[model samples]
Target: MTARTLPGMTTISYPPKPSPGDRIAVISAGAGLPGLLPRPFELGLERLRKEYDLVPVEYPATRKMGSTPQERAADIHAAFADPDIKAVIASIGGDDQITVLPFLDRELIRANPKPFFGMSDNTNLLAFLRNTGIVGYHGATVMCELGRPGAMHPQTADSLRAALFTSGAYELKPAERWNDINRDWADPATFEAEPETRPAAGWTWVNADRVVEGRSWGGCLEILGWLLMADREIPRDLAEFDGGVLLLETSEEMPSANEVFWTLRNMGERALLQRFSALLMGRAKTWSFERPNGPEEAARYAADQREAVLRAMRMYAPTTPIVFDVDFGHTDPQLVIPYGGLVRVDGPDRRITVTY
Candidate 1:
């Protein structure tokens, strides 16, 4: 979320970029799935070295499953403290990152700001970094994006490269094709080729008459709810969100359409929905291993999610500009959204640009 510029307070900073041949930290800040499933993790590491031309360094808890919150926090400290580590990326998202928040040393992370890349439950750290005046990336986790079956999505690779090495304005485009379903990671053949995909429907825009430019906030809706419940990171004064752009996405767990409505309704009750000038809703992920639906069922799921969001907005923030199905969440070919960075939503022109 955007931090207020108090007198004498340092302005929000985009952490230093990492160049080719520079060192980057790879930590399993959530579930240490790398220890349980080595194939995808190894593939991601190879890509970090061969494709990105950056050295990948792992911490003690990076691959250790069942590691304590203190252990994970220690790894984060070690990564940021190292002058040689130019950036940090999460191996994958998990369910319990909220627990690790209490153990983090804010002073250490603030002292050595670095670009951190992750999404989903890693939203905890992303919000944490923003409060410390550092911008964190909202997508491109190692096992999910970097270790996608076969080659990485060209769009994902290009966006990540820009975020890593450059500092400028970059446009975000809708994916021509996208995939939400994935094969079992335990299967040896899952990594032999790319997963199947379908044609993209592009984005749907509401309130296309005005432009909204502001600093961005928000993340996975479920994680944000947890943060709100724990009373952590979120500002006590709702004014902290005024004129901000809200970025939200769902995970593979697939909360029902009604659940989505209820969550946004809670935000509205707290006077949170009306503060943002615009909302960027990530493409809804429909299919999952537990409920593998056919094409028709998947399409219905996505439509339901869109309608649910629209219903909530109509009640809470009727005039706010919202663009749906932007490719940046659980969907394949994800874009790296700059958490707490400036985003320009040109509704009249149907374009989005983010300052890296």
Candidate 2:
């Protein structure tokens, strides 16, 4: 573990990164949707072996849909405690991840830290690892990004590979094309073609006049709200967030504009928003199986979500720089962001880079 310091963060330890041939743990620490929908999960494992040259080790509970928190927590402990496992990755994200928090052996995890990759509901574990002194990755799960239909997006593949094998400063680039709409993973046919995507414009900037560099924090906006309400692993000292770059994105659940506004509003009320030097709001996922929005409605939905974010920022962090539509959330072609790791947001040069 390399102990480092940023403006707002105390000493954060970045766990040693993995090499190409190292063994990686693929555990469904939150949900075992893999048992029900193995198409994507199996494809992801194949890619890990063939494309990435990493072997995946699964726990007994990895494919058990209704495993208890204790069972999942045991898998986590085992993954970290194993000397042969160079890294740990989640099979996918799920809503009940927050419930698994209490069962984690923080000391065991901290003592044997290895790069842990995940996002969405895995945000809970990411936040926990951050607090426990080990930096956790904020993107890339097996079934979602690696197991992407047809093939992994080149942009996403590049980001995940770097975050996994290399450790250095990596500059983030906007996706040439991107997608948030997903097909049913349950249907094997969905694996036959890549999801359709539209050309992506550059990220939107608000108050883009200066460059800000700091440690990154926050993830999966809805999961964050759950963590906050449950008073899970949030630091008692709000100062821990001061001068950090805030990272926030919603899930496929697609919370309404009003819900997004209220969540951020509540964070602002807690005096949290004002602590960040800059914010990276990920591209809002506009379509889901249930919503199946038309293009017009999808455009409106993204716009409204943007407005909702700006509304809360205006109230609590009026002048803070913000770059919207970063491709690092539930969106396809997602980029990996380091949790509790250094981020340099260059507004003047219109660049965003992360320390992988």
**Predicted candidate 2 versus true structure: per-residue lDDT over 1-356, tens digit per residue:** 21112234447878998888999999998889999899899999999999999999999999999999889998999999999999999999998988788888877888899999999999988988898888989998999999999999999999999999888899999888989888888887898899999989869999999999988999999999988888777777889988899999998999999999999999999898999999999999999989999989999999999999999999999999999999999998899999999999999999999998
Over the stretch 204-240, how does candidate 1's per-residue lDDT look in tens digits? 9999789988888899999998887787787666676
Q: What is the TM-score of each candidate against the true structure?
A: 0.97, 0.97
* Candidate 1 lDDT for residue 145: 95
Q: After superposition, which runs of candidate 1 have C-alpha atoms over 4 Å from their true positions?
A: 1-10
lDDT of each: 0.91, 0.91
**Candidate 1 TM-score to native:** 0.97
At residue 321, candidate 2 shows an lDDT of: 98
Backbone clashes per model, in order?
Answer: 0, 0
Clashing pairs in 2: none
